[model samples]
Target: MYYVIRYGPAEDNSADLYMDPIPGKKVSFTRGERLGTLPLLTFRKRAGDRGAFLDYLGSSPPCMVVSDRFVEALRSVGVDNVDFYPAQLVDEATGKATPGYQAANVVGLIACVDAAKSVYTLMPGLPEGGAIPKNGIFEFKSMHLDYTKVHGAKIFRLFETTSTIIVHESVRDAIEKAGLRGIRLIPAEGLDAFY
Candidate 1:
């Protein structure tokens, strides 16, 4: 199984675990409609747009426990056994629960990630729609990254508690700083498949 970590919006307690739009304000993507509505640009990375990235995080956070994108990214590449966590959970840093529908601090999110069970898989070539295999162990060079700078720190911390399967030395080294173990480094290229 592939484990992924995702944060919830700091909104009120009544919002869906994924912080889905309040009915009418929902936006849909070409692949499909996510439970939560985010601008298309939110998924695509922009050069040196850290503030924009941060603003997106500030407003939407990431209700990943129920995110279709999170699951689909892995699933599309034949890594279908994916799961997400840290939903409506209390923040360890703060003595209070995450803001239900309001807003939350980044530190609280860090705490939630530290307490979740996320799966990180390192693969070389990502699978395409027609050429996916049913089941087997495959290896390739690391080419892409599953998490962005905004996502890596928050989620990679959980690698400390789980037995993750990594195939790239650089990727392993990157996450090692976050305190990860159970590593099984292999040969691979970019992880573009997860995108």
Candidate 2:
């Protein structure tokens, strides 16, 4: 089976999830006319630009949930491998402006099911919650809705729920699965195969 994914935004009661187009705007994708109709399709939104609003968060947000403890006060509470369709750099020198900034190095895990893809977004933890600006990070706002309707590889975010430090999900899983565990199902995710 094959999985096609993209990072778009859909308005939610709490948060607006991004992985596809701005929702009801008739848009076309670079992939093809056929694949363009796919929902989870997303175009690459770059983080570095001349004038960026979201960039105000900080100069550089840490990439992984674990290690790289250079981030001032914000720490990694947990990490999840959000399945996302790789973004294509915009030609820039062209293209309009949107509210959100570009994609961060932080790997988001997107899942694929029934030829569709999903982004593993969760509520903002204490650290993430603290960073909430007058404008909040969409990731912090998007709560997984109708999770039962979504399926794909799952990445868990493990945070102390108190500290700002983040721990990688895979490492947490490894620790828990060590010593007294029976049968671990390696994710047969097609997202990994997409690359």
lDDT of model 1 at position 71: 32
lDDT of 1: 0.26
Worst 10 residues of 2 by lDDT: 7-16
Write down the worst ten-residue block by lDDT for model 1.
Answer: 106-115
Per-residue alpha-carbon lDDT of model 2 for 1-195, expressed as tens digits?
A: 111212111211111122434467553221112322223333323444443222112111111111112121112323333222223223234554333232223222222122223232233542422222321222322122223433422332212111111223443344334421111222223223211
lDDT of each: 0.26, 0.26
Q: Which stretches of candidate 1 lie over 4 Å from their true place?
A: 1-17, 22-169, 180-195
**lDDT, model 1, position 3:** 27
Candidate 1's residue-wise lDDT over 72-164, tens digit each?
Answer: 333333432222222232323332343222222111111121111222333346543332232211322233233332233322222211211
Residue 88 CA displacement from its true place in model 2, Å? 2.4
RMSD of 1: 17.0
In model 1, how large is the Cα lDDT of residue 15?
A: 25
